[model samples]
Structure formats: structure tokens, C-alpha cells
Target: MSIIVDDDTRLVVQGLTGSEGRFHGLRNRAYGTNLIAGVTPGKGGQDVEGVPVLNTVAEAVSAHGANTAMIFVPAPFAADAVYEAVDAGIATVICITEGVPAHDMLRIHTYVHNLGVTLIGPNCPGALSPGKANVGIIPAEIFTAGNIGLVSRSGTLTYQIGHELTQMGLGNSTIVGIGGDPVVGSSFVDILAKFQADPETEYIVMVGEIGGDEEEKAAAFIEAELTKPVVAYIAGFTAPPGKTMGHAGAIISGSSGTAAAKKAALEAKGIRVGTTPTETAEIVAGIARG
Candidate 1:
């Protein structure tokens, strides 16, 4: 069983008329997601390859029973789009637009938490449950369905690790790219809890980078709650101090958010921390084969 997305995901594209929205929205539909509606403000009354376009998210929800929203709008308009989706009672919202102001995400994070809405990102690659549902920009060809649950802060890294696992004949139950922005909707701990509760997820792979103390926080959670075996990979090991790496959140100030620090924290909690992505997959493969 997948954690967030599955065969029941009835998706609505919030910026369906735009280029990015149209491309990935149709791709998600082609991947078997129930692409029920599209919303592009004044561009209503039109259709994209047979999917109806609506004026608002509320209209999409009302007309097509769109419970999930996949947003591809501009960064400045992303927060408002999330608010509209939540207010319209959309259960899950995935924002694929990047560069949203940190202040906007700060507010959105709190707002979604209060309303209990599941928001993926304002700068994220989104989540994928292989052979079940594909929600965001995650490439669908690389994954195979299994019981290994994976979650990561970086999108490309998520794909790389996923590909590595699948190549080794280790399929995944669900892979969630929580995004590497300074502020995102879901945290590593948030997704980990869901994997912990999922009976189908036998093993877990956590891919974190050098950044905030999110890895440390997740270490604490795993020690206290999770009973399943976990293998982790923390990127940015060679990154210099006081310098920002690939991700906005992947900056090391002093030694607090260093890859070494995060790895040590996870290892202390009895979690195997891989030095590289392939190594991480090998570690999980060993456990699964055993």
C-alpha cells in the first residue's frame, strides 16, 4: 500500500493552461492518475486533451470531485493557490512551482497544519507511489512497486537513489520528494511517520542533505518511535562551511548542519548511514536479501 497517493487520486491541475502545468499534468494523466479537471482562471470553458478546464479550484472540487490539487502556477501566486485549494476542501495539494518566497511558505506551512491539509511543496519534485499514482514532476519510468519506503529533501537525489534501488531489483512502496527549500510543507519526520504506520513498507530509505537540523530531528523520532530498519544517505559531505550548496536549505553554518553531524546522529540511533547514494541502496539491498 502507498502512503499518500494511490489509484484513488482524482487530480486537478491548478495552472493547466500554462506550459509547465500542461506538460506535467498530461504526463501524470498518462501515468494513470485520475486527471479529472484543470483550473486556469479565465481560461475556463476550454479543455486540455479532453480534461475539462474550470475557473476555480472550488469549481473543480464541486464539478469533478477533485480531492487532490497539483499546482504549476508562478512562485508569487503559489501560496494563494494553496489557500484556495485548502479553502475549497481539497485534501491534498502538491505545489511544483519553485522560488516561492520563504516568508510565503512559512505562512503556508502553518496554515496547512492548522487546517490539517497535506501540502507537498512550493519548490518540490512531489511524491510518487510506483504503479499506483504519480502526482508531481517525478519521472515515472524509474520506479517499481515494492515495500521499501523512501523520502528525501532533494528531488534529483531522490530520483538517483530510486533508480539505484530499482536497478538492484529493490522496488519502493512510495518515494516522497519533500523539497529542499528553506521552508516546505512536509518534513522528513512527517513522511516517516506515515511509512512507519504503513504495513506494506517493510524497510525505509531516508535521503537528507547538509542543511537544517531536520535530519537530527528525524533521528530523534526514529529512536523513539520507528521499529522498522532504516538506511539513510545524507548529501553534501564535501560542501564547505558557511557556503550554500545546491539547495537553499543545504548550507552549513559552523558545524550544526554538516553531513557528518547528521550521519553521526542517525548512526547513533542504530540507523545505517550510507556514504553515497549507491552505497545506500546496497545497504538496503543487503537487508532485504537477508
Candidate 2:
């Protein structure tokens, strides 16, 4: 009942011959994720951990029914890797590579929408649906299956929050890292809408940072329509103005990316806002437990 992936989900690693592809792919398989195949052009005849290697996503998908693609290609070729998965009809694509030029991602974003495919990350820690599947580079030990749904722009922050929530006996239904790129795939509103409709999700935790108008848009949505209890946290409150924080998406241009603004916006919409990582889980658990 997770949004996209599950325990039975079949996965293929694009650029599987590379170090990142080999490493994370092995970790994913070890985590009980179904690692069906890997793709590396000109290395098609090889195998990684008994999983057949194909030169193209089309070949892998045709032969092994791999509907999900975890991409580890370099930034320059990352866009094409995404398109390859989409063309192969991959239902979900998770890109773990970072530093993709914004223009490349914008083009890929448009192409993915035209193809009706889902892209998870470009500079992200990836996502996990707890006991179902682990896509991207998120650590497997920090998650547990329960009632809350988490959406975050920071990978390490998401892990910390999940750990905190787990300590409180508050597990998650689906934990997604929407990435921290300026023009990346997915947003707070996108994941939040999905969680709002998911029956297994009773409460939600949204981890945001200072950047873009996405948080403002999410606040408007929550104020107008969403009924599920939302607990939100914004990072980079102590960051200096005009400086881009750790995340590429964590820029505060003319106060638009201030944590205080995000908190105020969410609070005005009747959502609880946490000032710190520890507080994030505490507030979420409070509303969820109540």
C-alpha cells in the first residue's frame, strides 16, 4: 500500500557497472529490495551479484520485467538515463547522482511528465517505503513501517527525523526525499497530496528548507483543502541571508527562503511547525498520538 514501491517491486540499476551503481545496488539487494537486473552499455553480457546486466534499460525491462530504475550515471549523462528508463516504461526512476545542471533536469522533467513517469531525485538521498523497497541512497536501518508519511528535501535530516520518530514508536508509511535541487522532481505539495489520499497514512511529517515558493503553495493547499494533520519543519533558520545553505534548494533570496517565513506560513494554515529536528518528531508524534 506504499505509494510506488514495495517488497515485491522489481528494480534495475542504470549504469550498474559503475562503483556507485554496484555499491548501492548491493545494499539495496541486501536490504531485501528485489534487485532484478542492472544496465551498463557495452557490459551487457556481465553480471553483478547474479543479476543479469544489460546494455540498455529497454533490454533489461523487456527481459526481467524491471519497472523501477535506480540511476547512478554521471551528471552529464543523467538526463538521458532518466529518459531511457521512461522510454522503457519504468514506473519509477530514482536518480542518486548529484550536480546535474538545472537546464538538463528541466528538460528531463518536461519529458517525464509527457511520458507520465515518476522521477524521485537528482541530488537527493532517495526514498524508502519501509519493508517494501529502498530506492536511492537512504540508509535502511532508520525506517520502520507505521502510520505516518514523511516527505523531506534533506536526506540526512530525513534520516534523523525518522530515527527520532522510531524512538517514539511512531513509524512511517512512506518516506520520500524529494531532493534539494532547484528544478528537481517532486515537491512538498506533490508528496503531501499523495499522503493525504493514502488510507494507511494517518498523520504526515513534511521537512522543508528555505527556498522557492513551494512551501507557500503547500501551506495554501493545506489551508484550503487538506484535512489530514500535518507537522512541518524548516531547516536553515540560522543561515545568513543571500547564502545558499547546504542544499541546492536551500537558498534564501530576499527572505523568500527564510525558515521563519516557512514556519509562519505553515502555522497560519493550522499546521504545526517544529523549530528543530528533535522538535520535528516530537510535534509530529504529539499530533499523531492525540
Candidate 3:
């Protein structure tokens, strides 16, 4: 019962001929994902260790029934790649390329929404449904299949929390790195809704950072909608105001997007907030054990 990806995911790598794309695409395939095809213009009819490489996404979909597209192209061409995937009928698109212009993403986000397609990231680590599918760049080895669902803005922090939970013998249903870009494709509420409805997911871990009102909005959603228990960890507790942190969206404007403010908002909604990744995993462990 994983959201976004599962055993049925037939994926096409958009930049499969490039070094980054080839490396991670094959890695995902090795992790057991059904890598049905690859897309590399001017390199059609080729193969990356046997995965068929086509010139366009439309060819991949029309021939191989590829429903998912993973984009590893450079930032300059990433948005057009997304448009190609969506127009070609790819159900889900995951863009791992970072540094995509915000305006380009702004247009891509609206376009996908209007077309009723799902987009994962422009700077994301991708999603993983342990033992089922690995869509992006999330490390597959640290995960085990279980009922815990995780959604995070920070990719590395998502990995840290996932590693901690695995060490505590807690497995995950799905781990979604929604990317830390300001205008990402998915939001915490969007992923939370999916996790809430997933039958196999029993618990959720939301990792937020200082930025926007995303965490605050997610707190509202959790209180009003979600029935499963959620444990949260907010990064950037010490980030100075008016400055951006590791993520472009991770900036503090006065006190509106401060870590303390976000934590308070969630705690007020009865969601336990953890000060650190390890502590957050410990809290989930206690809840799961109890």
C-alpha cells in the first residue's frame, strides 16, 4: 500500500544516457524497480546495460507502457522534459535535477495540476516504497517494508530519520522526499492526504524545515483530517532570520517561518515534535512500541 510508486511502476529515465542518469537509473533498476525504458535524444535505439533507450518520452510510453518518468537532465532542460513526460501520458514524473529556475517550476506546477498529473521534484531525492519500488535517489538499503509512512522536505534529513527508524526495527510503507524547492510539485498536505488514506500505513513521520507556511498548513491538515499518529521533526531551529539555509525554500522571514513557530503550531495540534532526527525516531519507536 505505497503511494506514488509500487511493484506496478514501469519507469522511463529521461536522461538515461548521461552519467548521473545512467548511474542512478541503473541503481534504481538494481534495487528492483521495473526500469522498462530510457529516453535520450540523438541516442535512440541504444541501451544502458540492456534497458532500451528511446529518443523521446512518447516513444517510451507508446512502446513500453512506461507510466512513470524520472528526469535526471540538467536544470536548463528539466522543465521541458517534464512537459514532454506529461504530454506523453506519463502518470508520474520525478525530477531529481536541482537548480531549476523557480519561474519554470511555477509554470510546470500549474501545468501538471491542470492536467491531473503527479510531479515529485525538481531538487528532490525521490520516493521509495521499500521492497516494492525505488523512484528517485533515496538509498534503498536503509529501508524495510512496514507500516510507517514518511514525508520530508529535506532529502538528507529524510535519510537520517529513515536510518534511525530502521535501526529501531521500524519499517516504512513509503518515504517521499517532496524536495525543498519553494515551488515544489507536492506539498506536505498532499502527501499527508495520501498517507492518511493508504490502508497499510499505520504511522507517519513528517520532517519539515524552517520555511514558508508549509509546516503550519500541514499541522492544520493533520488536526482536521489525518487519523494516524504523526511524529514530526523541524530543521533550521537556529537559522537566522532573513537568510536562506540549505534549501532555497528554507529561509526565515522575521519569525513567520521559524522552527519554533512551526513546532508550536504542530504541538498545538497534538502532534509530537522532535528536536532532532534521532529523537524524532525515538518518539515514533515509543509510540509504535506502546
Model 1, 21-115: lDDT tens digits are 99999999999988999999998999999999999999999888999999999988988999999999998999989888999998999999998
Q: Estimate each model's TM-score.
A: 0.98, 0.96, 0.98
User: Clashing residue pairs, candidate 1?
Assistant: none
Off by over 4 Å in 2: none
Candidate order by decreasing lDDT: 3, 1, 2
Task: Give me candidate 3's TM-score against the actual structure.
Answer: 0.98
- 1-290 in candidate 2: lDDT tens per residue? 76766876799999888998899999988888999999999998899979899989998788899989998999989988998899888988988888899999889888887877878888987778888888778887878999899898888899999999999988889899989998877777778888888888888888888888788889998877678888888888888888878777788888577888888888888888887899888988888878
For candidate 3, list the clashing residue pairs, or say none: none
**Candidate 3, 134-180: lDDT as tens digits:** 98989999889999999999888999999999999999999999998
Show where candidate 1 strays beyond 4 Å: none
- Candidate 2: RMSD to truth: 1.2
Model-by-model lDDT, in order?
0.91, 0.86, 0.94
Error of 2 at 225 (Å): 3.5
